[model samples]
Target: MNITISTFMKIAVTVIVISALLFSVGYQMVVDESNHYDSELDRYKNESLGR
Candidate 1:
Protein backbone atom coordinates (compact mmCIF):
# COMPACT_ATOMS: atom_id res chain seq x y z
CA MET A 1 0.00 0.00 0.00
CA ASN A 2 2.74 2.42 0.90
CA ILE A 3 4.59 1.73 -2.33
CA THR A 4 1.48 2.29 -4.35
CA ILE A 5 0.79 5.56 -2.60
CA SER A 6 4.34 6.72 -3.25
CA THR A 7 4.12 5.85 -6.91
CA PHE A 8 0.84 7.69 -7.22
CA MET A 9 2.27 10.76 -5.58
CA LYS A 10 5.23 10.79 -7.96
CA ILE A 11 2.99 10.54 -10.97
CA ALA A 12 0.75 13.30 -9.70
CA VAL A 13 3.69 15.61 -9.12
CA THR A 14 5.09 14.97 -12.57
CA VAL A 15 1.73 15.69 -14.18
CA ILE A 16 1.35 18.93 -12.26
CA VAL A 17 4.81 20.13 -13.23
CA ILE A 18 4.30 19.31 -16.88
CA SER A 19 0.92 21.03 -16.87
CA ALA A 20 2.36 24.15 -15.33
CA LEU A 21 5.16 24.31 -17.88
CA LEU A 22 2.78 23.88 -20.78
CA PHE A 23 0.45 26.55 -19.45
CA SER A 24 3.29 29.03 -19.08
CA VAL A 25 4.56 28.33 -22.59
CA GLY A 26 1.07 28.76 -24.01
CA TYR A 27 0.55 32.00 -22.14
CA GLN A 28 3.86 33.37 -23.34
CA MET A 29 2.99 32.54 -26.93
CA VAL A 30 -0.31 34.37 -26.63
CA VAL A 31 1.37 37.41 -25.18
CA ASP A 32 3.98 37.45 -27.94
CA GLU A 33 1.31 37.14 -30.62
CA SER A 34 -0.68 39.99 -29.14
CA ASN A 35 2.37 42.19 -29.06
CA HIS A 36 3.17 41.41 -32.65
CA TYR A 37 -0.40 42.20 -33.71
CA ASP A 38 -0.37 45.49 -31.86
CA SER A 39 2.88 46.51 -33.50
CA GLU A 40 1.59 45.68 -36.95
CA LEU A 41 -1.54 47.67 -36.34
CA ASP A 42 0.48 50.63 -35.22
CA ARG A 43 2.63 50.41 -38.30
CA TYR A 44 -0.40 50.43 -40.55
CA LYS A 45 -1.90 53.34 -38.67
CA ASN A 46 1.26 55.36 -39.10
CA GLU A 47 1.35 54.62 -42.81
CA SER A 48 -2.26 55.74 -43.19
CA LEU A 49 -1.46 58.93 -41.34
CA GLY A 50 1.55 59.51 -43.66
CA ARG A 51 3.94 59.49 -40.72
Candidate 2:
Protein backbone atom coordinates (compact mmCIF):
# COMPACT_ATOMS: atom_id res chain seq x y z
CA MET A 1 0.00 0.00 0.00
CA ASN A 2 1.38 3.38 -1.05
CA ILE A 3 0.56 6.23 1.31
CA THR A 4 0.71 9.81 0.08
CA ILE A 5 2.15 12.74 2.04
CA SER A 6 -1.25 14.31 2.57
CA THR A 7 -2.63 11.13 4.12
CA PHE A 8 0.39 10.86 6.38
CA MET A 9 -0.01 14.43 7.53
CA LYS A 10 -3.68 13.85 8.31
CA ILE A 11 -2.89 10.77 10.36
CA ALA A 12 -0.18 12.62 12.27
CA VAL A 13 -2.47 15.52 13.11
CA THR A 14 -5.19 13.16 14.32
CA VAL A 15 -2.81 11.33 16.61
CA ILE A 16 -1.49 14.57 18.07
CA VAL A 17 -4.95 15.88 18.76
CA ILE A 18 -6.06 12.68 20.45
CA SER A 19 -2.92 12.59 22.61
CA ALA A 20 -3.36 16.18 23.74
CA LEU A 21 -6.96 15.59 24.73
CA LEU A 22 -6.15 12.46 26.73
CA PHE A 23 -3.28 14.19 28.53
CA SER A 24 -5.37 17.21 29.44
CA VAL A 25 -8.17 15.05 30.84
CA GLY A 26 -5.82 12.90 32.90
CA TYR A 27 -4.00 15.94 34.30
CA GLN A 28 -7.23 17.66 35.29
CA MET A 29 -8.48 14.58 37.10
CA VAL A 30 -5.26 14.30 39.08
CA VAL A 31 -5.35 17.93 40.12
CA ASP A 32 -8.97 17.72 41.19
CA GLU A 33 -8.39 14.58 43.29
CA SER A 34 -5.36 16.12 44.97
CA ASN A 35 -7.28 19.26 45.85
CA HIS A 36 -10.13 17.20 47.29
CA TYR A 37 -7.80 15.14 49.47
CA ASP A 38 -6.00 18.25 50.71
CA SER A 39 -9.22 19.90 51.76
CA GLU A 40 -10.38 16.75 53.52
CA LEU A 41 -7.11 16.52 55.41
CA ASP A 42 -7.33 20.10 56.53
CA ARG A 43 -10.84 19.56 57.84
CA TYR A 44 -9.73 16.55 59.81
CA LYS A 45 -6.82 18.47 61.31
CA ASN A 46 -9.09 21.32 62.35
CA GLU A 47 -11.50 18.95 64.06
CA SER A 48 -8.72 17.21 65.93
CA LEU A 49 -7.30 20.51 67.16
CA GLY A 50 -10.68 21.62 68.42
CA ARG A 51 -11.17 18.48 70.51
Candidate 3:
Protein backbone atom coordinates (compact mmCIF):
# COMPACT_ATOMS: atom_id res chain seq x y z
CA MET A 1 0.00 0.00 0.00
CA ASN A 2 3.00 2.30 0.61
CA ILE A 3 5.18 3.57 -2.17
CA THR A 4 8.97 3.35 -1.96
CA ILE A 5 11.49 5.98 -3.08
CA SER A 6 12.23 4.15 -6.28
CA THR A 7 8.57 3.81 -7.11
CA PHE A 8 8.01 7.51 -6.48
CA MET A 9 10.98 8.41 -8.64
CA LYS A 10 9.69 6.28 -11.49
CA ILE A 11 6.24 7.86 -11.32
CA ALA A 12 7.73 11.33 -11.16
CA VAL A 13 9.95 10.70 -14.16
CA THR A 14 7.05 9.32 -16.19
CA VAL A 15 4.86 12.29 -15.37
CA ILE A 16 7.61 14.72 -16.28
CA VAL A 17 8.25 13.07 -19.61
CA ILE A 18 4.57 13.00 -20.47
CA SER A 19 4.12 16.63 -19.48
CA ALA A 20 7.09 17.75 -21.56
CA LEU A 21 5.83 15.93 -24.63
CA LEU A 22 2.31 17.38 -24.31
CA PHE A 23 3.69 20.87 -23.71
CA SER A 24 5.98 20.59 -26.75
CA VAL A 25 3.10 19.57 -29.00
CA GLY A 26 0.85 22.32 -27.70
CA TYR A 27 3.60 24.95 -28.00
CA GLN A 28 4.39 24.01 -31.57
CA MET A 29 0.72 24.19 -32.47
CA VAL A 30 0.48 27.73 -31.15
CA VAL A 31 3.72 28.70 -32.87
CA ASP A 32 2.41 27.42 -36.18
CA GLU A 33 -0.85 29.34 -35.79
CA SER A 34 1.02 32.51 -34.92
CA ASN A 35 3.31 32.14 -37.91
CA HIS A 36 0.33 31.72 -40.19
CA TYR A 37 -1.37 34.75 -38.73
CA ASP A 38 1.78 36.85 -39.08
CA SER A 39 2.16 35.99 -42.75
CA GLU A 40 -1.42 36.89 -43.39
CA LEU A 41 -1.03 40.15 -41.53
CA ASP A 42 2.10 40.95 -43.48
CA ARG A 43 0.23 40.51 -46.73
CA TYR A 44 -2.43 42.92 -45.56
CA LYS A 45 0.19 45.39 -44.38
CA ASN A 46 2.00 45.32 -47.67
CA GLU A 47 -1.20 45.90 -49.60
CA SER A 48 -2.28 48.77 -47.36
CA LEU A 49 1.14 50.35 -46.86
CA GLY A 50 2.01 50.09 -50.56
CA ARG A 51 5.39 48.58 -49.65
Candidate 4:
Protein backbone atom coordinates (compact mmCIF):
# COMPACT_ATOMS: atom_id res chain seq x y z
CA MET A 1 0.00 0.00 0.00
CA ASN A 2 1.71 3.19 -1.24
CA ILE A 3 0.22 6.70 -0.81
CA THR A 4 1.70 9.53 -2.83
CA ILE A 5 1.94 13.19 -1.83
CA SER A 6 -0.68 14.22 -4.38
CA THR A 7 -3.26 11.83 -2.99
CA PHE A 8 -2.64 12.97 0.59
CA MET A 9 -2.91 16.61 -0.36
CA LYS A 10 -6.17 16.03 -2.23
CA ILE A 11 -7.71 14.21 0.70
CA ALA A 12 -6.62 16.89 3.14
CA VAL A 13 -8.03 19.68 1.00
CA THR A 14 -11.32 17.89 0.49
CA VAL A 15 -11.75 17.33 4.23
CA ILE A 16 -11.01 20.96 4.98
CA VAL A 17 -13.50 22.23 2.41
CA ILE A 18 -16.27 19.96 3.64
CA SER A 19 -15.62 20.89 7.27
CA ALA A 20 -15.72 24.60 6.47
CA LEU A 21 -18.99 24.26 4.53
CA LEU A 22 -20.65 22.34 7.34
CA PHE A 23 -19.49 24.84 9.96
CA SER A 24 -20.75 27.79 7.95
CA VAL A 25 -24.18 26.25 7.44
CA GLY A 26 -24.56 25.32 11.08
CA TYR A 27 -23.41 28.75 12.27
CA GLN A 28 -25.81 30.51 9.94
CA MET A 29 -28.74 28.46 11.14
CA VAL A 30 -27.98 29.28 14.77
CA VAL A 31 -27.58 32.99 14.07
CA ASP A 32 -30.81 33.15 12.06
CA GLU A 33 -32.77 31.43 14.76
CA SER A 34 -31.37 33.73 17.41
CA ASN A 35 -32.24 36.81 15.37
CA HIS A 36 -35.78 35.59 14.82
CA TYR A 37 -36.27 35.02 18.52
CA ASP A 38 -34.87 38.44 19.35
CA SER A 39 -37.19 40.15 16.88
CA GLU A 40 -40.21 38.31 18.21
CA LEU A 41 -39.34 39.28 21.76
CA ASP A 42 -38.91 42.91 20.77
CA ARG A 43 -42.27 42.96 19.01
CA TYR A 44 -43.95 41.43 22.01
CA LYS A 45 -42.46 44.08 24.27
CA ASN A 46 -43.51 47.06 22.12
CA GLU A 47 -45.97 49.15 24.17
CA SER A 48 -47.26 51.04 21.12
CA LEU A 49 -48.66 47.86 19.71
CA GLY A 50 -51.24 47.84 22.53
CA ARG A 51 -52.95 50.86 21.00
Candidate 5:
Protein backbone atom coordinates (compact mmCIF):
# COMPACT_ATOMS: atom_id res chain seq x y z
CA MET A 1 0.00 0.00 0.00
CA ASN A 2 1.19 3.47 -0.87
CA ILE A 3 1.56 5.95 1.99
CA THR A 4 0.45 9.29 0.59
CA ILE A 5 -0.75 12.49 2.22
CA SER A 6 -4.36 11.35 1.78
CA THR A 7 -3.60 8.05 3.50
CA PHE A 8 -2.02 9.85 6.43
CA MET A 9 -5.01 12.17 6.72
CA LYS A 10 -7.42 9.22 6.65
CA ILE A 11 -5.54 7.42 9.38
CA ALA A 12 -5.46 10.53 11.53
CA VAL A 13 -9.19 11.08 11.06
CA THR A 14 -10.00 7.47 11.97
CA VAL A 15 -7.94 7.65 15.14
CA ILE A 16 -9.62 10.89 16.17
CA VAL A 17 -13.10 9.49 15.55
CA ILE A 18 -12.42 6.31 17.54
CA SER A 19 -10.96 8.33 20.38
CA ALA A 20 -13.98 10.61 20.49
CA LEU A 21 -16.38 7.64 20.50
CA LEU A 22 -14.55 5.97 23.37
CA PHE A 23 -14.52 9.17 25.40
CA SER A 24 -18.25 9.65 24.84
CA VAL A 25 -19.06 6.07 25.92
CA GLY A 26 -16.88 6.31 29.01
CA TYR A 27 -18.34 9.66 29.98
CA GLN A 28 -21.90 8.34 29.67
CA MET A 29 -21.08 5.29 31.79
CA VAL A 30 -19.63 7.53 34.49
CA VAL A 31 -22.73 9.69 34.40
CA ASP A 32 -24.97 6.64 34.75
CA GLU A 33 -22.96 5.28 37.70
CA SER A 34 -22.96 8.64 39.46
CA ASN A 35 -26.69 8.91 38.95
CA HIS A 36 -27.21 5.47 40.47
CA TYR A 37 -25.14 6.36 43.51
CA ASP A 38 -27.03 9.63 43.94
CA SER A 39 -30.37 7.85 43.83
CA GLU A 40 -29.22 5.36 46.46
CA LEU A 41 -28.04 8.16 48.71
CA ASP A 42 -31.33 9.97 48.31
CA ARG A 43 -33.22 6.81 49.24
CA TYR A 44 -31.09 6.33 52.34
CA LYS A 45 -31.60 9.92 53.37
CA ASN A 46 -35.36 9.63 52.98
CA GLU A 47 -35.43 6.42 55.00
CA SER A 48 -33.59 8.11 57.87
CA LEU A 49 -35.70 11.25 57.80
CA GLY A 50 -37.50 10.42 61.05
CA ARG A 51 -34.38 9.40 62.89
Candidate 6:
Protein backbone atom coordinates (compact mmCIF):
# COMPACT_ATOMS: atom_id res chain seq x y z
CA MET A 1 0.00 0.00 0.00
CA ASN A 2 1.23 3.44 -1.01
CA ILE A 3 0.08 6.69 0.54
CA THR A 4 0.64 10.00 -1.23
CA ILE A 5 1.87 13.15 0.46
CA SER A 6 -1.34 14.96 -0.34
CA THR A 7 -3.42 12.27 1.32
CA PHE A 8 -1.26 12.34 4.44
CA MET A 9 -1.44 16.12 4.66
CA LYS A 10 -5.17 16.05 4.32
CA ILE A 11 -5.52 13.54 7.13
CA ALA A 12 -3.25 15.54 9.38
CA VAL A 13 -5.14 18.72 8.74
CA THR A 14 -8.46 17.03 9.44
CA VAL A 15 -7.24 15.61 12.74
CA ILE A 16 -5.84 18.95 13.84
CA VAL A 17 -9.04 20.78 12.98
CA ILE A 18 -11.14 18.26 14.87
CA SER A 19 -8.88 18.40 17.90
CA ALA A 20 -8.97 22.21 17.97
CA LEU A 21 -12.74 22.25 17.73
CA LEU A 22 -13.15 19.78 20.55
CA PHE A 23 -10.73 21.64 22.76
CA SER A 24 -12.52 24.92 22.13
CA VAL A 25 -15.88 23.43 23.04
CA GLY A 26 -14.52 21.75 26.16
CA TYR A 27 -12.80 24.92 27.31
CA GLN A 28 -15.94 26.96 26.86
CA MET A 29 -17.95 24.48 28.88
CA VAL A 30 -15.43 24.60 31.73
CA VAL A 31 -15.48 28.38 31.75
CA ASP A 32 -19.28 28.44 31.83
CA GLU A 33 -19.45 25.97 34.70
CA SER A 34 -16.84 27.88 36.65
CA ASN A 35 -18.76 31.09 36.19
CA HIS A 36 -21.95 29.44 37.34
CA TYR A 37 -20.32 28.10 40.47
CA ASP A 38 -18.79 31.49 41.23
CA SER A 39 -22.16 33.19 40.99
CA GLU A 40 -23.78 30.56 43.19
CA LEU A 41 -21.09 30.95 45.80
CA ASP A 42 -21.51 34.71 45.82
CA ARG A 43 -25.23 34.38 46.25
CA TYR A 44 -24.78 31.99 49.16
CA LYS A 45 -22.36 34.32 50.84
CA ASN A 46 -24.71 37.26 50.46
CA GLU A 47 -27.55 35.28 51.98
CA SER A 48 -25.43 34.22 54.91
CA LEU A 49 -24.31 37.75 55.62
CA GLY A 50 -27.89 38.98 55.60
CA ARG A 51 -28.74 36.75 58.54
The number of the candidate with the highest TM-score is 1
Q: Which residue ranges in model 1 land beyond 4 Å of their true spot? A: none
Q: Per-residue lDDT for 1-51 in model 4, tens only?
A: 256888988999999999999999999999999999998888887855882
Candidate 3 residue 26 C-alpha distance from true site, Å: 1.0
Query: Model 2: per-residue lDDT, tens digit, 1-51?
Result: 356888999999999999999999999999999999999999999999994
Candidate 2 vs candidate 5: which has greater lDDT?
2
Query: Residues 1-51, candidate 1, lDDT per residue (tens digit)?
Result: 999999999999999999999999999999999999999999999999999
lDDT of each: 1.00, 0.95, 0.96, 0.91, 0.94, 0.95
Query: In model 1, what is the error at residue 38, expressed in angstroms?
Result: 0.3
Candidate 6 has a TM-score of 0.91
Candidate 4 Cα misplacement greater than 4 A, ranges: 1-3, 47-51
Ranking by lDDT: 1, 3, 2, 6, 5, 4
**lDDT top scorer:** 1
lDDT of 6 at 7: 90
Query: Considering TM-score, which of the candidate structures 1 and 2 is the better prediction for this target?
Result: 1
TM-score each candidate: 0.96, 0.88, 0.78, 0.77, 0.86, 0.91
Q: Give the lDDT of residue 27 in candidate 5.
A: 100
Model 2 segments beyond 4 Å from truth?
1-3
lDDT of 3 by residue, 1-51 (tens): 356888999999999999999999999999999999999999999999999
After TM-score superposition, what is the CA distance of residue 36 in candidate 5 from its true location, in Å? Answer: 0.4
